[model samples]
Target: MTATPVDTRPLAIDARGLVKRFDKTLAVDGVDIAIPEGAIYGILGPNGAGKTTTLRMLLGIIDPDAGTRSVLGASNPQDVARRIGYLPEERGLYPAMKCDEAIGFMGALRGLPLKVGKERGRELLEAHGLGHAIDKQIRQLSKGMAQTVQLLGTLVHRPKLVVFDEPFSGLDAINQGKLEVLIRGLADEGTTVIFSTHVIAHAERLCEGIAIIAGGKVPFTGPVDEARDRIPAQVRLETRSADGPWRAALPGDTRRVGNYWSFPLPETGVEPLLKALIDGDAGILSLSIERAGLHDAFVAIAGEAAARDMVTRGGGEAA
Candidate 1:
């Protein structure tokens, strides 16, 4: 029987030992990220966690101090820039320029001829419900309309790789939904899409894999389910009798959150503890194993990094 080969070439977006320093301050420190092709990857981080810096480095807008990075197999930014589309967190649009003109300009920058760019711009605008805004100046459009225009411009060239930095920031619920659908459609069509967001719920909904970055570093990187699985399942106990000894019977790591007693599953088994709670006259109002939530995991990792940075800064200040 022939053995199947493990395909482990460098990922679609791979950064190895990436470091960025400005004077004495290090923004991104020895970060390594690997994003697969045709995947919706998210970089989940709070503001100023080097997420933007990382994205900038990936797109070759800025160079790293020490590392190798590539996008779509192109090691040089100039060579790869044509194949990648980026929507930066800071929305940049020529306010006085008409919507059609703005998008066409961006498309032209990506090497599309004027006629083709104009036609493509119209198609995208009309398809995205901006048909009437073709002649309207960006200054005359609402924030949502402007945002849609920017997004349409980013995709007008059909770049194989799209990087969105906080793309959903100012979008309301309705527009956010529209953007989500558009992003999903892009990924479904084989675009290697990656976006950065501080919103965990949005990441959970849109990303197949994610890298949770905090304090200028990535603490978690993998598939969403794999990340969740790395966190032990919590056994939740809700009892009518709050005064029961069942709390003490559980492991030391077990915690009381509100009325629920959460005990992490033991390496060996939880059956013994389950039986103990039953035998102890605990009402057992609810007994269930709760999988780790993405928010919970993000908090756990990000909080640790933040606390460590605080302690380090405190020591430096005292010295």
Candidate 2:
């Protein structure tokens, strides 16, 4: 049988050899990304890994020292700025502005008329469960509520592409869950969502494709499952007998700790091993296969040091 062809969707954001420098420091080096339209993509990395720099260059927030990019089919990102929405890592809103007004202001910035922005802002507020705060001042809301308002503003214009940088930062567990739902909802509506996050769990849960960046360079990029497949699936077996002829069937690398024997699943498949176990009078108590998680894949692909840095930062903004 032929293997399934990889995703051939049209590109929403195509960037190649993007390089950026801040004074003497090389912030991003030769980054290339092709995000398929309507797919949820993630830029995963540790702090100061040049994720923000790469994003800024893609959005035309900053010019790359080298390389090229196309945003929403336009060679110049600014030409299509109205069709894209961005939420930077640093969140800010005028404290004196009412919630609806703040959201409207954001929409207006994206070319929506002030009146229409206000109307849509109110509707967005209601839709996101922030209607009660529509008339309230930004200063009066809690941090999570304020962040939600800013996020609502980002969506009020209904842009085709949305980019969020460390969006999960500063959010509590419940708010984080809500944000995940909101992101999936955006994708369900055919919006292309690209988010930069050091949190691997978020990328694993939401991203169809990801670019793993470390030290201002991309170490790996592609489907989430492909990354996970870099590490082998592990097998856990429990048997009534610790030693028997069936033990010989276990892979040489198998380890015994207490009552469990763990090892990488055999290439020949489990059927042969099960047969040997049964024939050798080894009473199997239980067995399970555990697929490798994104965390393990991250460590293998991005290196242990980069993975440690990611864990150390844990959702904080990149330097």
Candidate with best lDDT: 2
The 10-residue segment of model 2 with minimum total lDDT is 310-319
User: Lowest lDDT 10-mer window, candidate 1?
Assistant: 310-319
Tens-digit lDDT track of model 1 for 170-289: 889999999899889998898989998767788889998898777777888888876777778878878888867766678898788999988787765777777877888878888898
Counting clashing residue pairs in each candidate, in order, gives 0, 0
Candidate 2's C-alpha runs over 4 A off are 314-319
Clash pairs (backbone) in predicted model 1: none
Q: Stretches of candidate 1 above 4 Å error? A: 1-10, 239-249, 252-260, 269-285, 304-319
User: Each candidate's TM vs. the true structure?
Assistant: 0.84, 0.96
lDDT of 2 by residue, 22-98 (tens): 78988899999999999999999998898998899999999999999998899999999999999999899999999
